[model samples]
Target: MDAYDLHSGNGNNLSGYANAQIDGIISALAVSADPAERARLLAEAAPVLWDEMPTLPLYRQQRTLLMSTKMYAVSRNPTRWGAGWNMDRWALAR
Candidate 1:
């Protein structure tokens, strides 16, 4: 909920939304060491976040890759570096 957090928005929250409850929840999550408490805080925040709809994106990021079945050692990097990150290790199938 970084986008929803008032302090953590980092310009990602296009709507400029702010919620005290959400902010408190996120703050608690940050310092919370107990797994159960963290889980509860997250669970409590879900409904509030959904109902708020602070900044819903019009499009989700989708990564697409096309590879031949005959190809082997194809790198499937999912980051912005792209799939050819390990090109040096790539080789064709026998």
Candidate 2:
């Protein structure tokens, strides 16, 4: 589970949920019209926000499993653009 601490200015009272950091981040991001400002707020709040009391972080989980027989090459890097991406290929034994 992912979580973040909350601050009074971040607004954790309205939701009534014990953990509402994701809401706070969305609210902060929504309040800003500028892309740079939105990014700035996200970066600033990431360290101190979560689902307890004041801050909350949205939880994201990535899962993967692989099976192969003759495959000899595969890439699992998330940043790769083409076949090197997580979906590209899988290593297998011949």
Candidate 3:
């Protein structure tokens, strides 16, 4: 949200995107502690963000993981962590 906020500083908001409604939602989300309320806030914010389109994704990485069907316990770790991050827990069906 900082990236799209009106008063974001420290180079956090490069796009210079600003919207009052989103700003209020971002402020509320920042101090919110309740998980349900946070989720509700995010739910309320997503469509507004989409409609506003502060920034557009220019490219998307295409990832592929090939494994035998018997493979189990494979975890979808972040790209920086790599897919084998949880290799110890991986197993194969008999």
Best prediction by TM-score = 3
lDDT of 2 at 2: 26
lDDT of 2 at 47: 60
- Model 1 agreement with the true structure over 2-93: per-residue lDDT tens digits: 43334344465556677878878877877889999988998998898788776675876566778888777886785555778888987778
Which 10 residues in a row give candidate 1 its minimum summed lDDT? 1-10
Candidate 2 — which pairs collide?
4-49, 4-50, 5-49, 5-55, 6-54, 6-55, 19-51, 21-56, 50-55, 50-56
Q: How well does candidate 1 match the true structure in TM-score terms? A: 0.50
lDDT of each: 0.72, 0.51, 0.73
lDDT of predicted model 2: 0.51
After superposition, the stretches of candidate 3 with alpha carbons farther than 4 Å from their true spots are 1-10, 58-94
Query: Which digits, one per residue and each the tens of the lDDT, describe model 2 over residues 1-94?
Result: 2222222233534443443455567567657789999888778665655323342436655656354646666645443234446544555575
RMSD, each candidate, Å?
5.5, 9.5, 5.6
Tens digits of per-residue lDDT, candidate 3, 28-90, equal 877889999989988988898799887787876665677889999986765444688889999
- Model 1 shows how many backbone clashes? 0
| Model 2 CA deviation exceeding 4 Å by range | 1-26, 50-94
